[model samples]
Target: MSLLQKIQDLEDVLKKEQLTVDDLVAAISSEIACNSYLVSAEGKILSYSLAGSNSDKNADLALKLEFKQRVGFVFQTVANLPLEANFLENDNSFAPNTHMAIVPIHHLTSTAGHLLLTKKAQQFSEEELILAEASSLIAGIYLYEKANENNSDSQHNNIEMVLESLSFSEIKAIHSVFTELNGLEGFLVASKIADRIGISRSVIVNAMRKLESAGIVNSRSLGIKGTYIKIKNSSFLEALKLKVR
Candidate 1:
């Protein structure tokens, strides 16, 4: 809507919804106060309240968004990474206005989405850069909140997929016994791992007949009781811990 029309609509919505414009404006105004610009999670124009906004040159911001989106898919494939993992800096070019960061809305350690600063000039002062990064962080958190509110089905599916991948019956058989592991320290035979996983000795030997089959545990002999060591999967084992937690 045009500015005048938006004002009228805001007035109508506030009256109809029994809310306040300050409540709406305060959220947008906060970004304006910080960086003079704001963007939607998809990098669309949410606002360019400040006159000097370089939103037109937000390609750097756009690339960062794409990178974050690709990595954010990890929410479906991996466990929650610590804040410091994905929250690290991209590039420190030191161009004040052009300085930007990608902040993702993440919950349960998975990024649901992110937002970017709308614009900047050739350079941003340290203060402006700080404000831009802070604003991006705020936008990320807000987007995550909104996605959580809306995408219950997607999250549910992800949770189920995670559980299934982690609990593949054959993989679980090893995890069930990893802590109590028994193996040849000097040169035990491979039969021990088979015994631990509850498969017959011949099954273990014959299992290696095929390669790269899922749900089959692989083993290698090192030495002593640790010789025949069971290897379910490094990545899957790690994923299991993540999903379990």
Candidate 2:
């Protein structure tokens, strides 16, 4: 079935009755013919669904272990919203050419967790990518409500402080860098950001400097080639997403 049709069917089921996080994981996995995991921002597994025997029969202990080892990597990749399919290659733990769709589950503006979907197949279609993103957003909202119910005032206060640290321009730069993350591009340079936002290179560099001081981005010089920049952590992207929005 098409990805859109599968998503519509899932929505129908979701509307019929509330499903626990685990139930949602299983349903998403089945609909997409892949293994699905809901992991906390700190890389704890909240729920997971193993592909059925008829599907991806190689979903074995080794595969699970591989995912365990790479869960942090997965979260880091999708900490920013709207990321493309990340192709994990040359990892003996998984089958050759495994594709992982990493989606950040946000709470309000901050990322509370991640949804990781994996299949031993080629790249996912654009339709599948859209479905994965929508599923993660749903999961994020559910998790956000759950966290709010359990969190103390001090935690919320701390999060607010972090959100207030960045200026608007810095947030935009971070957002632009995150939106471009894909298999083809990893780290972004200042010039790229300048061109993307129609701002001057100097202005972009100044923003990056502030972001670096805030520990949101890391930069390095390549001599004549100029400097390249990257987000320092996934959590920073989450916070920036919340602040910028």
Candidate 3:
């Protein structure tokens, strides 16, 4: 199919009511003939669609971890990554044969996230790179609209009462970890955060309890999946003086 036709198809997909990032990833994956992922600027995997056959569960998990790590590295080090598509050679021992391309998804002048494409033993062509860049622009617009729709006045005031209940260290711990978390739909293991930040799990647990009691956050224990937490109020992060990336 011609690139213009493929992009037109994507535009048709976007016209549907309640279109989602997963839907976008699936459409882009079909056009590019590779696994595609939409990752948040904070390194959270927003959505993904795999091409061809699916990998086993273990390999799939490894791939997600690798993507998160790579995105985090890009956010930390590549402050001025261009809007055009760029390639990253996979040095991961678990998936050494993988070839990856990334395009920054921008919200106006600032980057909001990334569009990632990966396939084994196949390098992306120049045409594919252009298509990916176009896809990123569409994804950015969708995300910006969603963000505006989700904004609430209650979110700005929800943390005022909770602030007095938290200690300095507790606030610091919560800011350090929770800022990385994707709201509601995205969950991370609490122990994993503790391990990564070199803090005791008890500190995280206590902070969560206080926040939950104040109705500022909600959490559910997922057994082996650890804790799934969603911030009810983003103002808490701002109140704690969390640094914006």
Candidate 4:
């Protein structure tokens, strides 16, 4: 297939929400007719489809370790190069004919991971190199989107935890003050909240303490500047029934 057509096929694979990096690697392996792996920047093998079989678990572990070391060394060696495919000739006696290509998977300006391909006794064609680069880009996008989703879920969970920790009165106090602020940025005075809501200063202070303790907010006394309040989780606005402004 032409490189453009192969890239279009990879794009179709990416459109599937259920598609994983492993599936993507497998597709790339089939397209290029070689063993493929997706290794994280930290040298963890995220996905792979090796040609040979290891009969023993220990052999598999050793093989994985050796691959990791190889990837790490090559990654460090080419760290200064532009994000592209780099070829290496393997010296391992066990796989004398093995030739490897490493493509750095990039997310924006940062290296997110890598796409590694190994072929026995054959140098990679230009078309194969370009396909690997395209695959790496797709893998980077997939990994980055997954990371964002996980972060958003974690933030939502934290907001729920803080919401569960609050008493009805405390929620009311928080709603009153935050609503009055109307998405204003900067420090807010506890006494100001107390005066506006007709609640005791101690009530406002305690509520802030709970938020701070839950890691949902940050509070610091600015002395005459009242108290510096910074909400770490913006989802708290919707959770507390306040405007998300």
Candidate 5:
């Protein structure tokens, strides 16, 4: 199969597995031919993928980022760092660590989390960025789906609980709008969300807009057919498992 097709196949697996951030990090590291992959969520290691067999990874790498720095600045560096940027761009890089990429994940308006991909500096190529970004996109979809599922179960759940680092309001008032809602009948309209929420048409419209932006639901105009919203992804328990892994 073509490279793009292989990538797409990986995407399908990611979607099917409800691939967590950790899964994608492994996929990225393996695909990029990198030695190891380390991912931080809010600075703490969310996942790690070692390139070759290593008895002790921690004892081997001398260079590392501060716990706090890894979460914020180091990751920010990955996102903003330009093409071909090396060692200076991310302290996570040292000799034998040639390639690296940082990505920022955001759903709706707020930042969801970050992803980092590293290869030996000498080993990285532009294609790695493509691979990394593609993985990030898939990861974003996975997280977005998880966030929407969380919303269904919790009254105050607004954020997707990425990395356990994010903080937000209960969205209690906002959620009340949908409290009375029941599976949209067939598919709920803006009016239903607005009426149940006891808000103005504009407010309901705005809420749906935000929810759609977060990929919690999908909205489509039937044109002459009808306009409706479809719930995005179900709960983690209900999500499909792509493979045995």
Candidate 6:
């Protein structure tokens, strides 16, 4: 996808009623090629993403443990900062030479949370820092909208209407299919989507058939190659992202 289209996708993901902190992390991480974390002002780790191998897992666990232990201190350090971004070569939770950046997430005029980005490299360029700051602003807007929507009765009803007919697994299947098929032609492989979603192939196939019957997707048999799938109605697929906001 073009950079502009990717940005649009991120914005769309944020607006979805099903938006979560991990979704935010995943979007930013996938865009920037690094681990991303969202932490609330109250020292809670809202979401995080670290994609890789066994060493990555070890590092991820250690980082989470350290964050849990020292999140309060980290919060306090930037609690009074303005709408600017900052970087630290090493923090209480990170080793020396580890790269970390902190960006403020504001809701309207007040701060709501912080975005923490980490990479194995020792430093990030000024351009990257600016991008991080911008990403944090987007995340803040998402959080603000989510908070308001959750408190709005009208939004609640709309969300229920959108999700009432879909089961959790079906929703997941739709989301997986939609994300994978974005900006692509031909067809999406159901088994690959099933693997990525951590669900069985049979489940994914059933979900795809249901979606096809509902006009949310077009599915065709490829004989021994299995089913070839394509999203038919993107708006409907987007609506499937509705959450109990």
Model 2 TM: 0.45
Candidate 4 to truth, TM: 0.78
Q: What order do candidates take by lDDT, descending? A: 4, 3, 2, 6, 5, 1
What's the TM-score of every candidate structure?
0.29, 0.45, 0.51, 0.78, 0.47, 0.45
- Candidate 6 regions with alpha-carbon error over 4 angstroms: 1-9, 15-17, 51-96, 153-245
State the lDDT of candidate 4 residue by residue for 22-140, as single tens digits.
Answer: 67877788777777777787876676765553322222222245556665655321211221233322313235566777788877767777777777767788788877777777888
The better-scoring model by lDDT among 3 and 6 is: 3
Per-residue C-alpha lDDT of model 1 across residues 54-147, encoded as one tens digit per residue: 3343333323455445544433222112222222234342233343333344445444444333234433344444444344444454555545
Q: What are the per-residue Cα lDDT tens digits for candidate 6 across 1-245? A: 55566566667766667667767888887776666777776646577776342223222232344444454344322321221222321223343445666676766656687877776644655545656666887888877776776756554454445456667776787677767766423566777888887988777777666666655567788876756666655455445655412
lDDT of 5 at 52: 53
Computed on alpha carbons, the lDDT of every model, listed in order, comes to: 0.40, 0.63, 0.70, 0.70, 0.50, 0.61
Q: State the displacement of the C-alpha of residue 94, model 2, in Å, after optimal TM-score superposition.
A: 3.1
> Which candidate, 1 or 3, has the higher lDDT?
3
The lDDT, on a scale of 0 to 1, for candidate 6 is 0.61
- Descending-TM-score candidate ranking: 4, 3, 5, 2, 6, 1
Q: Model 1: runs farther than 4 Å from truth?
A: 1-133, 139-176, 182-190, 193-198, 202-245
Query: Ten residues in a row with the worst lDDT in model 2?
Result: 79-88
Residues 111-155 of candidate 3 have per-residue lDDT tens digits of: 798877786666788777777877887888889888976755445
Better of 2 and 5 by TM-score: 5
Task: Give a tens-digit lDDT track for model 2, residues 116-162.
Answer: 77777466667667777778766776676566656545445544565
Question: Higher-TM-score candidate among 5 and 6?
Answer: 5
List the candidate 5 regions with Cα displacement exceeding 4 Å.
18-21, 35-41, 52-97, 121-123, 156-245
Local distance difference test, candidate 3: 0.70
